[model samples]
Target: MEKGTKFRIIKGIGLAALVAALVQTGRPSLAQQQPADSTETKQDVIRVETNEVMIDVVARDKKGRPVRDLRPGEIEVYEDGVKQNVTAFQLIEADSAVASSSEAKSESTVAGGTVREAPRPLNSLRQIKLVTLVFDTLGVESRRLAQQGALDFIKTQLPPNTYVAVFKVGNRLHVLQQFTNDRKFLEKAVERATTASHPQSEDLSDKIRKSLEELRQMGAAVGAAGSFAPPGTPGLVSSGAIKSGPPIMSGDGSVAMEKPDPVRLKLIEVTLNALRFTEDTQRASQGMSSMFSLLSLIRAQGDLAGRKTVIYFAEGIQVPPSLNELFRTTISEANRAGVSVYGVDARGLDSARTMRSSRDMLVAAVNASKSQLEKGSDVALSREEVMSTDTAESSLRKNEQGALEDLSISTGGFLTANTNDLRKGMGRIGSDLGSYYALSYTPQAQTYDGRFRQLTVKLSRPGINVQTRTGYFAVPPTAGAPLLPYEMPMLAAFNRHAPGKDFEYHVAALRFGASTNGVRHQLLMEVPLKNFTFTPDAPKKIYRAQFSLMALVKDKDGRAVQRLSENFPLEGPLEKLETSKNRNVFFTRSVTLPPGRYTLETIAFDRATGKGSVRRQELVVAPVN
Candidate 1:
């Protein structure tokens, strides 16, 4: 129990009662109050469809090295060019199943005769859904020694069922932490963001002298209270007194000058037009709306489509170049929602003397305030605006490494740099998320013309290198309706890792025990109902089934806390001559949970040949002691 002390006693007694039981049973208001013919008989029995394929494979090794092993029949898949047939094969194996379940319970109690009790072990490894951690602290000026090495590299390389979240842009974008897995509340939110510094030039000269004393007390309370006026204030006070009549003061004249209160000068001209929304423009618009609200809350928490992984961590910069089409439509909707984006440069773990003493204290405070405004003195910026703000901060550090290499090549994702060798870039992102491999197919262009299709994954034998996700978007057949096989396996379990599209109906498994109405929790599913097959002789047969289940209760650094979802019914029995012998079926549900670790997901469908399947599992619940 030392994976950081069972992730801090299961994240301090089950993450707030499993996030209040996953906001009371996994949302959609308890699957929209059941009936509607039980949600159209679970969307006329499942009909899942998902796509997100970007496996660039080239793991060389004729002596090339990157050949970590290569399986799934030595890999080979394609799409827009055709070739298919690799049904399903997941690799992702970074070892540590809690140190291989404590070395198989210490080699089974020293090979004794009574220490039995195995069961509880099935989260099938591969877990890393977007654990982003970018705390460059905008060139760290010691903010507690760069927040003690970014909270000791997020409490020593976070992992346990991982879900971590943190954002720090410096000069603005702060969320210090959010998608927690609670490494001591993300190490006290990186020690309360090491008292953030480095907005430099003396923190933008104390934010432009607190924006000119809050714009001169908001233009003297909008010139003595004219209720926030300003829609052509007499055409800006008749073009400033038709060029000069409002201020005639001479050598100690008793009436020196007073006409300036058009409602406290329009509340100091709208508080200096609301300090043009500063704080580094609200931390680059709250770090791009907290990275698209943590990718739309991990795609509305439906176990992020196919095999997901986000990892981000930044230092690279693309903040508002109109958010590059919202970061290429959020990495093309996280590659059609199968998510995958690994970047981690954190300014390549800085420290070239903390980036040359924070660029030599911002070029010696902009060359001593441009040599005191080129000698005229009272410097409020000029000397050609401090040499054009040091040439736009040297072109924003050379366009932040080409905007983190175009957001890690438009999201197929992979860019680990520096951070004192971020553990060899998180061990090459945990060996490319554990020897990556998951190929799917089935896109004979079947309508859904939403556009972008292109994909290619091939490897009949050359040096492997496929990294995945290049194109998707097809989606349209009137946006494929007629759902009910449990809403077509929860909408093809939200696109079971799309690409070519057949990755063994996206598998997800989990189970837990201790019944007697206490800590039960069972969520077993074996999707893969593909087009509802069965034909011995058929005459008037009509079978379409689908299913979807969700269960949550996370701790151990995975967050969530608790949730549950249901929508099953893949009915059977329709024969005129023969073909209804209950072709494998099973759906069960029970939840009592109180103790710990829980994450159960199931999505299945077979809407008369549309295809759908997904299964995920993880249950622990043991603790009533």
Candidate 2:
């Protein structure tokens, strides 16, 4: 009810099938409008801020039924282990399919020194359920199962207050529908999402199979070749290709070695190159594009009110090591926005193909070992040893699913994997979305130190369970949310009455073709390397520079529409340090905005020296032709 209030809701109900049907509510309209595809009349942007933090507590008894009658005195809130005073309390309940406005029960209790009744009606509290169904690229079989699972969930008839949106994640995040309770619109969106699988996505499995075959071929070539010489000598060659006798002594007492076959050497080189190509292909198959699309969705959801839930349906979310930072950022943003991601592995009842593949590879290895043994090669491997090895498929599957688990569980949600009955999983998720106890408190630590503040909710009663987010960063709230560390500087610069040109930098806002979503523009910031301070690590013989670049795009009315931020960690050999100072660092980011004129404020801060530069530029986005 207040500006800048931070709300934390406990994790939603248990697993169930996803993308269900919903009915309209008697509460205030929480349905969100879809983004305009074409340029039209301008609409002013409004933002609200709050200083209070709200936590949604779900207390259940031994029987797993919600404990609805708990009083504020019976509950204790702790932030960073310090007990906090409860400022406001309310119970938000999910309306039944046939329930009317009058039948819904909304209770409120605000306490300072004494508890008092709420002055506003239940609908004014804006206690509504918001869910977004994101369908990632899937294989043919997975698409079928996912579609059916979503359709079944929809037919179950969700709560009247539950509003749903549909999106498809591929090369980009495509919104099929905005927030709505209408079953027809949601159904149509799901249809399009299910049928709109990326063309290349279906070929992903084929590509992996081909890559594996290439790896097998390379492995065979390596096995066929005898012992390898050290570097600088001839590489792998056919067994016995070299002389089996001792080295011949020359007249000068030098040992002359037999030359290796040129054709064999060429084959080895080709195989090695193929091995490298296969490795790169597998890493690319880990779905970096999908991860970025998902990030875009979470960041955009930060602007919405209350806690949001994302039902992410994908065959599997494989996050490679290189994308670790991006994955963490995705989770961090979701936690900040109070979004719980429930990942549903669409590969229902995964076939035993993985196990079969492992078996086949092992068999080939055993045959090759037998051939080597027959040839009296000491390098031959034992069949028993190869058979004793664990199946790599099991470990690989666990690793592939680890990303999904971490992404979901870190944000107060769970992953449903290796299950054929997606309907059951969605049913649990649906129940979790039902309702919870809303508690508000003002944190005692007023300093926005950008550090994580641990949160724990304790109940005085026994045999009761409470579920909520683990913690939140101690950042001051703005626009109903907190500005991230990298974002804080950009906003500060935008709000300054006078620009501080601490250093020299060039910025360009280049406009591109217009699309349905908005006009595409590239924001580029260039700064001389000499503008930043570099610290030299004598032992490592490298120079390091730390800094960040950020920008804020504000409309004509002075309301911020978009904020971009990025950090640069520069390091180079000491020999190149001087040369680097003569070069410039360029940063670029693409953003889409409605066709209109706006002011772009940019900042470049050197973290090492704590020095920064601020600049302003005017940009215009022409409407679509």
Candidate 3:
């Protein structure tokens, strides 16, 4: 019940009696692993020999027909001005692409007339087309159009062998649906996105418009008065401009006036409105949160093979000067994942409305400044404020539009804007996602200091346009080095207070005693067998299941000190498989750590159904007496 106290759930402990009966003899009753310290020296010496970078290129003829027959020799790939050897090349056709594991499974007749699932071949002719639909902040009309466009695309424009997933990014990221070819499920996800609400640009711009209107009204009121002082006049207000006859001495000896000068009042009002507009403009340009959420999503798909495209739907992403680097990072991450971002302006033809409002606001501020000057007022400060506000707002407007274009074009995708019919844009995206030439080459420099590496793809033939990512940031791939895409979910769960609800499991860590290697601890997990989904292996005459068990040990400072992961391939006689329902599975992993407080995080992931549960517990290693 205390904060930072790890909750220990000791369920299914009695199932230890059934472990021997369930596991085959001589294989250890349950999963066990040698101590991590024993292999630490060997793992520390491991280094990546060569890293291959993949690039997706879409080539089309002048008339817009795909030119897929181009050979590797005809295409030249350059990285940072250095031409590199093409290591891999593949032409992915829409109809030939196979994306999902379920769809890729093939059954073959084996001995005894039994059917066996053929192992998916490596480097096969068929590639995958993975597309993600991300819906961001939208107004009512734009949301409706986006929903309709998505529904139509799913119903008609969706190409064969393409897998689509739906996601919504608001204050945080929400996965509406995972990748699938089912049209009905995708449509249902679009329906769910219809009612999803976040901050709307329309509302933010409307507030700004009202402030500009107020400024204009104040300017008009000043212009209509002819008695105001001119630039050369001695005083800012004329002798009769002030309504008050003269200052009067009250009983308290405080000077009393009938009314304040209208010119001064109007000047103050104009300044406040200009300041409000500036503040609102800054607020409107904030989009770092959504960018971070998108980065997470893209990284999750880093290991996914084939062409991955993110069709991002929103009015436009606004990246202010402060967030420019973050925006670039988003593009770089997308390129690293081989994911293209196709930005669709949900406002369609009305996309320019914000810019128009910004221009109007600038005009109003400039006119107000001119009026202040004609009234013989000290307009130096106000004029500078107006000019700076106009410049900032204009820059923000340009950056908002530029964000969409840069994110798309930099990642080998295009932007769809200024059109009411969004479905046509979706159609183009489908065609673009379906057919592409994938190529990879090792960078000649091999330096990964996080610098942006410019990529140029040239063809020997003319009249053909090649579209690919501009380049990727020089960075090491960490997805499978020590951490994996599937492991990310568990790491996230380990950090958060909320436990995973996909299933229930128990985990505990016990420190035996101090040995020559410091301290030895055993990590144990007991999971119900019913949590896993078993598939009938016809050829093996048994039902088989597979799941990945991972343990992450972190020191008191929350830094991962050791990581252990292994896959469990379980199988049993088909008739006796029912007995697994009432039984539980146990796994043990040994970890050697120094005498310090640490946390052990574990996750049991069902590979068949894609379900997982993460549990954490605290372990304290005391010094020997």
Backbone N/Cα/C clashes per model: 82, 25, 0
Per-prediction TM-score to the true structure, in the order listed: 0.25, 0.55, 0.50
Tens-place lDDT digits, model 3, residues 1-625: 1111111212244534433443343122112321221111110112235777888899999988888677655778778888777765666667756321233554333222322222334332134466778888788988888888888788886676566766676554555544456676568667766674444422322333343344344445665354332233221223432343222111111121223344223322322332342222222222225675566666656656677788888877766433444566678778887889998888877856747755665576456445433543221223223233333444545645567888899999999888888777887787887788776766677554556788899998989998889876655565222233334434444555444556776665555556786776656677776788878767744566766667777899988777665444554444445554445656665556788777667778787875677666666677667
What is the lDDT of every predicted structure here?
0.40, 0.55, 0.58
Arrange candidates by TM-score, descending: 2, 3, 1
Kindly provide the TM-score of model 1 when superposed on the true structure, using C-alpha atoms: 0.25
Best of the two (1, 2) by TM-score: 2
Quote the positional error of residue 580 for candidate 1 in Å. 32
Task: Give the per-residue lDDT of model 2 (tens digit) for 1-625.
Answer: 0111111111221111011111121111112212212111222222324456765566678877767677766778788998877776665557632212234443434233443223334541154466778888888887788888777667673665566766676544455544445566567667767875564332332332233334334444665354433233222222343353211111111122233233223222322232333222222122334666665555555544444678889866654322443456567666666677888878777846424544564565455434433543223223222221122222344455666877877776778878778877787676667756666777787765555677788888899977665666655544312254544544555455556566786666555666787976666566776888988889965567767777777899988777666555555445545655655555555677897777777788787765677776666666677
RMSD of each: 28.6, 27.0, 29.8
Best-fitting candidate, scored by TM-score: 2
Which lDDT value does model 2 have at 336?
A: 64
Q: Candidate 2: lDDT over CA atoms?
A: 0.55
lDDT of 3 at 571: 43
Candidate 2, superposed: residue stretches over 4 Å from native: 1-50, 60-70, 95-121, 124-128, 177-188, 197-308, 315-338, 347-400, 445-452, 473-483, 493-523, 528-546, 552-563, 569-584, 589-601, 615-625
Q: Residue 567, candidate 2: how far off, in angstroms?
A: 2.4
Winner by lDDT: 3
